[model samples]
Target chain A: MVLRRFLPALPPLLAFAGILAIWELLSLYFGLDGLPPPSVALRQVPVILTDPQSLFDIVDSLRRMAIGIVLALVFAIPVGLWMGRSRFAAAFFNPLLSVIYPVPKAALMPIIMLWLGVGDASKILVIFLGVTLPLIYHSYQGSRAVEEKLLWSAAAMGMQPPARLARIVLPAALPEILVGCRTALVLGLITMVTSEMIARQTGIGNLVFQSLEMGIYDTVYAMIVIIGALGFILDVLFERLRGWLVGWAEPAQSIIVGST
Target chain B: MIRFRQKQRSFTFERGFRLERGLALAFAIAASTAGLTAASAQTIPTIRVGWTVPAEDAKYWMMKRPQEFPNLGKKYNVEWVQFQGTAQMVQAMAAGALDCSTQGVLSLAQGAASAGLQTYIVAQHVGEKAPESFSVYWAVKDDSPIKSVKDFKGKTIGLNVLGTGIWGPLAIALKKNGIDPDKDVKLVEAAFPTQEDAIRTGRLDVGVLNQPFAARAEAKGGLRKVFAISEEIPDIVHILEACSKTFVDKNPELAALYVQDLTAGMGKALANRDETLKIVTEIFKAPVAVFDPFYFKTRASSDAPLGSADFARDPGAAANYDGIQKMFKLYYDVGMLPKQLDVKDFKHAKIFAPLKP
Candidate 1:
């Protein structure tokens, strides 16, 4: 039993080692002259980790991600739920979503920057646009999947329409909703870095860009390692949170299974 | 009567036949549009001028801002693209996207000699600096311990980027002052606009900048020049207008006109300082009061004043090929250029030899 459990973890570790070995080989022989070897890049990590500003970069990045995700959820969830339930809402928002969702929102950064003047507000807005569409679409699909029987059963118990939606539709639809959140979680983190790099003067993305501009390639790779570690941790945290939230919905596993 | 009826039917049939022919012709035209576009490309010459624009290295005189080149508009169409650095220009040239780009010799050699891109230097200039004027300065905060390049050992120095105009001469200067560029000091790269703040806040011990920025920082009152690059590499040709070989071979006349117009424009600007300042003010969208009283503002690296004979009215000082060749040899000796990049290789004798009139 111990061997089986430990054996699964070894593959991922071996994959990481393989990647490092290839990167080192390339940097030495095949890669562009300016690129630092994996060993050289990794050596700078302790230095960056000990720096107070580097710590601030992590906290700042997380804060931006939180603000952006919250804004997305607040706007997307209600509109999405309403559209799923009410035909009037769908008619109002669906056309707009179809028009805007296909456009690359990052291309609009300059016009947005003109108005917001390259600050936190502009970065957060772009991040909101980046993740919100998928959130709304998934939420709409999840709410729409709530069965007529569940709604009828709630009504039979003399429950009001709002209460029925709250108790039956939302909970039953959460499996798909959490899946949407999972995608948005990844997207929101990506947007957080990109928006900072495009406009703002701070954050890990800015640090990476500034370092590369200065020919500090080792520092660039070090920041990447930090960002990758943060992304992995955040994704795991989100996975655990989903399991905890919908554990009762699935007796055998976690998350609300979308059977409706 | 039967024959008349036959004539009316024939007329109707003829009209139908004509409509069918028209539709077939439209379809054929639509089908061969890709081929027609290829043919159309050769009939007209489009001058695509690329420049990594900075305050010191602005090419606003190109006259191709909205649509057409100012002087050669009747002969050639113009398209423009702006880049942030020579590295980007080199990348675009390698991709066969850029036709002509203005850059320094250091970057030109890097592309031509190191990367083996077929490009030739067509025009040259000493940007924002006269022969007697000090251009690129290394600056420090008010009370920093770094008095000169010798003091730069173990201290952080700010640069724009590596393997470009500023980095090449800076390496020479540091070596001349008994400092190894690789180990003696730390180098940080920051944008020119942000350097003043970085220097004032002590984020960088010394920041490399060119006028009017170097002059502007001194005017701001807490910064002082640590050393001037002109002290080491004086009269080095600052900007070289280079073109890809394909563009030169395909459109030799347009290429010559491009260089000639650019040369004439620079000569006119150098002679008429007031008109140039007016143009600069208009381009930057600032009032007259923002700039120095003279176009050639000079600053000293030490406590002494800049050695200037007020300012001579030398218009052709910037068109010195000897100066460019000297900077070329300096870069090659310092290993900024590839070992094989001869001075002759930079001089494409056949095409667009600049008239220094």
Candidate 2:
């Protein structure tokens, strides 16, 4: 029974190990200076973590990302839900969102910095813009799929419109909203790195580029490993939260496909 | 029932219209207040300058050692913006987001010829000094059999980009050596930081390096230099400090003060190498070891006395119009520029006039 309790974690661990093995084999076979092997890269991970400045930059980046994600969630969910419920709201916002969706959020960094100086505000704003679209999209999907009969029943029971949206639609749509949040989390990290690279300010992205500029290949790869690990950990924790929040809902069909 | 549904739809439309109008009014009020605040705060004109490489650009030092530049925050305030590359800086300038920036001659020509951006060459940032100064280096693995430029034929070459400062000189060198740059060699775009590793790993037969990267590669000591860019284009103006003509014309006094402060700051920084390196280290957040060997090395020629400390920037000296003209012509010849530009037309003579003795 104890073994069974821990069994669910085994596949991911095995898969991660398999990936490392493949990476090591490839790096050794290529023997390229630009492409350091996993062992060499992993050794530098501790060095990076130990460096106070690098650690601070990374933590600062995470702080900006968290704030951006929270801001996006606060703003995007209501707009998305309103659009899902009212045709007018959807019509009014769809065109604007469509225009913005195609533009890479990182590309807006230079223009945004011109308006709002090259500080935390600009970086956080870029991350927020990047994460908002997916959240809005998923929330719209979830809220739109909420049972019409349930909403009608709540209305007959004298529930106000706002109360019905909060208590009924939100919980019903939590699963899809979480999925959107998962995608937004990934996008937020991407935008954070990309904007920092463009701005060349203090952040993990700046550290990565600075290391690249200095020809510190091991440090570059080490940063990659750290970011990848962060993404993996965040995704796993989010999956647990999703399971807890929507345990009553049917389990999503697991498809064997490429990783997100 | 149909009449009642129609009435409900009409009421919803009215509510939506009213909400939209209210939001529009709020946005207008907020925007006007922000504009007013910005206008009130602009006591002194702020020159938004963009820089890429901190170790190379003097603006980085000027901003770091504010005391050395007395004109800063008094005559004009400087707002420094760090960019990833010249391409991004060019975009920022075109967008009117940047007032002044460090630009390569290729980009300067491209900006004027292709984008029609009226940018004036304000001062020289970096240039080659013959026989001693090397602007760029082409290197191969120490064990590679390739000995000279002729051997570069049919071999892969790594460059930071295809048609920037390095490409024109390299093309001239290759063509002079009877190797067609286009048909004979395969040019791959790799970042400067990765070029050393790329060469060492045998991925590239030759990797081009400049300044700090060249210093790092030399310290590592496995790469052999095939040729230097200065050998082909002697005394080539590698980079120039350029500003939009509009900015220079509108605020000539501010522009002049900025140039004076920059020149003075560079002089002071070069005068005290150890202190300057400390500031640079703090700015880059990297070790002083990265820039110690070659950051401010100026070769002693007959014209330029020993310990004169050019540091590849001579803001007080005359603009190298001949060298710049040659570069513009080369860029046009190589199709990097859409049209030929007269170098003299783009020189901000008014701003540099005060520097004349």
Chain B alone, TM-score of each model? 0.76, 0.82
Best by lDDT: 2
lDDT of 1 by residue, B1-357 (tens): 112111111112123333345336535644453233242344467786766433322245554232324555566655655444666567567666668876776777777777787876776544434445655678888798888778888998888675556676678878888999999989888776557667876788988765445545555567777776666766666666788888888877777777766666656666555766676654432345445443554433334433221122224323446666777777788877766455566556655434431
Kindly list the per-residue Cα lDDT of model 2 for residues B1-357, writing each as its tens digit. Answer: 112111111112123333345336535654553343243376888998877764454566677777666678777788776778887778678767788887888887887777788887777667776655645779999899899999999999999977777798888888888999889999999988778878987789999877677777777688888887767777788766788888989988888888777666656666777887888776665667777766677655644322222336553434577999998888777666788889878886566522521
Estimated TM-score for each candidate: 0.52, 0.78
The second chain of candidate 2 has a TM-score of: 0.82
Tell me the tens digit of each residue's lDDT in model 1 across A65-180.
67677778768877787788889989999999999998776666655655664456777788889889988998899889877877787799899987765566666666677788
* Whole-model lDDT per candidate: 0.65, 0.76
Of candidate 1 chain A, the 10-residue stretch with the lowest lDDT total is A251-260
Error of 2 at B245 (Å): 2.2
Q: Distance from true position, residue B29, model 1, in Å?
A: 28
Tens digits of per-residue lDDT for model 2 on A62-176? 7778778877877998888888999999999999999999999998888887676666778889999999999999989999998888889889999999987766776677668
